[model samples]
Target: MSEDWTRLSAAIRTARKARGWTQHQLAEKAGIGFSTVQRLEGGAPFTRRPPSLDRIERALGWQLGSADAVLAGGDPEPTGSVDAAAPREAGDIGAPPAKRLPRRIEHELASGEVLDTEVLQLGNSRVRMIIVATFEPGDGDDQEAVAEDLEAWTRVQHQLRNMTPSEGNP
Candidate 1:
């Protein structure tokens, strides 16, 4: 393995152990396979590369960083400790974003789950669906729903390619 891979491999192993997950558990949670986790730890080869990072981040809820932060009272905190919601168990968040969720989300946003949705027709003849997602500061694990939505969108796009806009079959 390359030096970067070696170091990252060790770090992933450490984080997984720190979270008290067996490789199989982590794999299942990340929506990946057991062999992927083993190869990642061994650094045998980063065959899946970038997507692997997404899976790992999804399984761990948060990824370690190297930034430094200062608390309100002037205490310098270590980097990689961006724990916005400190939950009791590892990855026990109510719901988390997808492993491949777009990180460049704009607009000041918050995380939530859909409790209700209502469709409204606007004055400008545009219709919008207002979904109410119940939320608190997230514990940040469990990306299954987001993953499912993403997969659904992908299928929608594929279906769209076979249709013409004039066909009323939308």
Candidate 2:
């Protein structure tokens, strides 16, 4: 099906302006090149990647696939019902502020175990994550076993990040 690049471009521009962000700022937040965002906003013909579009959509606080929907002549759905026209506060950039980065984040596994991780932003478009600790429910932990499990889990996350869209996700 043909896509309306014009519509997608306008929608992206509107969202970026609504957030009081320049093309460079959006590019940084989306982890994409400045030219990509500029070309997209200018309605210039260019090859599109799913990951790039997904990042741009996420950076704009739009739901995943919002860009594709807009290109198809439909409205982009806002993530968490955010109003694009809402006024932005001073220094309230679209991306999370550096000081607001989580020092620690915990996730509970379906098996009732807990995984602790720390996520660090190394620089633009580069992030490092460390598994701090893992807790098994109601049992003494083995240090060796915990290390192995964390290593295996990290490898899986790496695989997922590198997988193409057609591969889908487990």
**Which of the numbered candidates is closest to the native, going by highest lDDT?**
2
Model 2 per-residue lDDT tens digits across residues 1-170 = 77888889999999889888888777777656778788889886556533467667767888867887898889998887433343334344334312222212322333355565555443343445444445565467678777778788788667645644343321
Best by TM-score: 2
Report lDDT (Cα) of residue 49, candidate 1: 46
Worst ten-residue run, lDDT, model 2? Answer: 97-106
Q: 1-109 in candidate 1: lDDT tens per residue?
A: 2235565566668777887778876766666667878987885544334445555664665542210111111222233533233332444432333533433221113
Model 2 alpha-carbon drift over 4 Å, by segment: 47-50, 81-170
Q: How many backbone clashes can be found in candidate 2? A: 0
TM-score of each: 0.39, 0.47
